[model samples]
Target: MPIPTSNGHASRVQIQEPRTRSPLPPSSSPIAFKEQQGRPPPAAQQTIAGKLSRNLFKGILFSQLTLISLLVIVLTIRGLILASSHHFHPKKWYPPLLASVAVSGVASLAWQCIFIYNPPRAVKATFWLTPILTCSVGILLVLIGSAVDAGIGAVFVLFAITQSLYGCWITPRLEYTDKILSLSTAFPPARTREVVSLSILVSVVYSGFLVTGIGGATSTRTNLDLLFVSVILISLAWTMQVLKNVQQVAISRARYVNFAHGEDMDAWGAFRVTVKHLIGSICIGSTLVPIIVLIRGSIRSVNLMSGSSDEVMYSGADCFSTIANKLITYGNRCGFVHVGTYDKGFVEASSDTWKKLRSTVGLEKLIDSDLTSSLCFLSAVSVGAVSSLTAGIWVLLIHKDYALEVTLYAFIIGYFVGRVALAWIQACVLAYYVAYSEDPQSMRFDGTIPNRIQRLQLLSARRDNRELEVGRDRDDTDNC
Candidate 1:
């Protein structure tokens, strides 16, 4: 048949029978078909088909309790076995333990002096209170751990002890700091409760890992070796999660401190965001772990191959390890900066952090201040040492046969608890640094920005203006 066209030319129209459809090749599976369709595989589809419901708080509680239970059982069994097999001598360990306590106290005092030297009057109390709280919590936890038998009751008693101590002592002091820092203006009751709850959850997880590690150390079973590995992995996972939460809290706190409107994001909401970005954050954190491990491994291999018993080899390795550790730590601090880049993609946040750290007048030094990190460590160490000493004395007087085991347990538990207790304070310090970096003028030092930061801001502004002028002048000349 022919159809007439608009140009007066006749065009032929042909019709043909429809061809049969060919089936997919035998080798092509359903998965392949889905892939061709840009869809997920059936298994994956089914995996996520159910309603996405994860109660993080409940999960945290369950995991913490379960881990604590396992740890207590293992420790209890180990203690029983040790008591039956070996005799403990309190006099043998007493001198070294006491010496350790003395050294820790001296070191803590020295570090505190470095931290508080010529510090602003406003933050002086904050710095002072941190060590005090750390010591108090550490001592209290050790006392509880030493007094109570390893059981479910022990867990409850520990929590009750912590709650009573925090409420009676720490909370009031923290409240005073809140008033000093005007934190109430930023943190409503709901927000404060969320922060406190999350902090407690993190503390529970940290304490569980610590207890598990200590318990595992007393056993030499193959099963415990496996369990130790599991504990390490789980601990790392929880640590990463806690660090991410800290970043979110830091950002929120910074916003509140700056009087930003609509900054009242709930803790659950922040946690959800953290979960959404968990993979990316883990990838960022994990990259450093492997590199550090590989470097240390390589150094060890070189030492073995060289067979050089020289001090130079050891010193070099130590130096490299320190550098690697600092690099990793700096990377961690950068995570908080990434948090400050609100709603930005992970790549962009990482890039921005890199740029800032590389900047000549940037906040790298301020954010990675030795005062913040060292003080926390020293505080924990000091408290742990003192707890060890106390446990030794108690064992000497009461449980003379179980002196070594109890003292070791107290020292390890106390140190971990102390560190976890101060984690919130560290978050706040990071938040302050972030706020200052974002807007120096917004930070309140006695109700006004600090003179040094204000001057730095002015200098930065002027430098930016000059760069703009230079760029514009070059553009005008190029046009001519």
Candidate 2:
């Protein structure tokens, strides 16, 4: 061979070939590697098992991400709306708004602790127990208030409404459970989402009405007292509707499960049955009371303002002053009622005017009384009871009339008693079924729970290992 020359000056010169990198191994190439292994192309002849696993993983990842994203978007929207409405400003609505937020947070935590979803049996137990307990307290308070006076009943209703709403907001956020799950055949996820959306809209409207109506209600046949009563009525009616929905949900869940178990239960059939019960119970019981209160209060307010009664002061300034004094005096008396007999004196003195008119129609007694009379006493008793237990609470407390104070006291005591009774009933019902029940699905968990758990764990581990192996293969091919 002739020597290579740098300057090509020699008679003969050899040129070295330029270096070029070797192509990748057949194992690394998309088509060639597959052919080398005597296997079909992955896209065309992918193993069914591998494809299924990949699809499942992708689905799980997508679902998890979607849920997280949805939650974030909802929260962001709510925050933006609140901010734009100036409700987020600390100077304006912060006190009540913050209070509501704090209450809602705590309520949510409580619901998660008590009613978080687990197995079917646990879910049923929780659902049955919660409604009976909550509704019983509410009903008992109503019954007691009827006997004593509205003042007593009104206090319980207010507490029940607030607590219920707080629980409602919290359940979906934390535990993804709904107390109203018993109300409709709509899926809990979908139903709760709708309910929350609707509730937010309703709340905003209600708040706007409240803010605007406050001044108008204070004079000219419109007083905060009457406006507040209207609000309470609206709230009560809304609550009843929610309760009806809750019943429908329960029936739907039951029918769905039944159908899944090869039974003949259908959604429409269950819905009809649910509607009958809901209309009979919640519609009649919850909605009626508030509606009647609203009507009576409206009539009373219209007549009082239009008439030349001793209470009427037609001058704008005089009317404003009178309204203000009435409010202040009412608030003050409500606080004072529980401490001494001052509230009782005022209530007795106004028995002909604001006192409850007891009359028996057929088998039931219709006790007609104004919500104002009821609220004053209820507020005073609650305030006083709290004040008595705590020192500085006295400063924040108000007193109302004697009958109202006693009525409120009775309502609170009745609620406590009702809770206990409801709990006992649920326990009894659960114990009865657990002891004497023979369910077909029992075979599903016939083996020791630990054995099933172990199987699940093994499946998970195998899946994880397959993923790891696939990842490792890609990394090796890249390095090569």
Question: What are the TM-scores, per candidate, against the unseen true structure?
Answer: 0.45, 0.25
**Residues 347-465, candidate 2, lDDT per residue (tens digit)?**
12122111111111110011111112222222222322221222111111322222232222222322222221122112211111121121212321122222323544566689999
Candidate 1 deviant stretches above 4 angstroms: 1-190, 201-262, 267-330, 340-351, 357-362, 368-370, 386-390, 400-405, 441-450, 453-480
Error of model 1, residue 435, in angstroms:
3.4
- Mind giving the per-residue lDDT tens digits that candidate 1 earns over 14-81? 00111222232243232332221132112212122121212333355357657755765675456445
Q: Where's the lowest-lDDT run of ten residues in candidate 1?
A: 8-17
lDDT on C-alpha atoms for all candidate structures: 0.42, 0.30
- The runs of at least 3 residues in candidate 2 whose Cα sits more than 4 Å from the true structure, single-residue gaps closed, are 1-102, 105-114, 117-480
Candidate 2 backbone clash number: 27
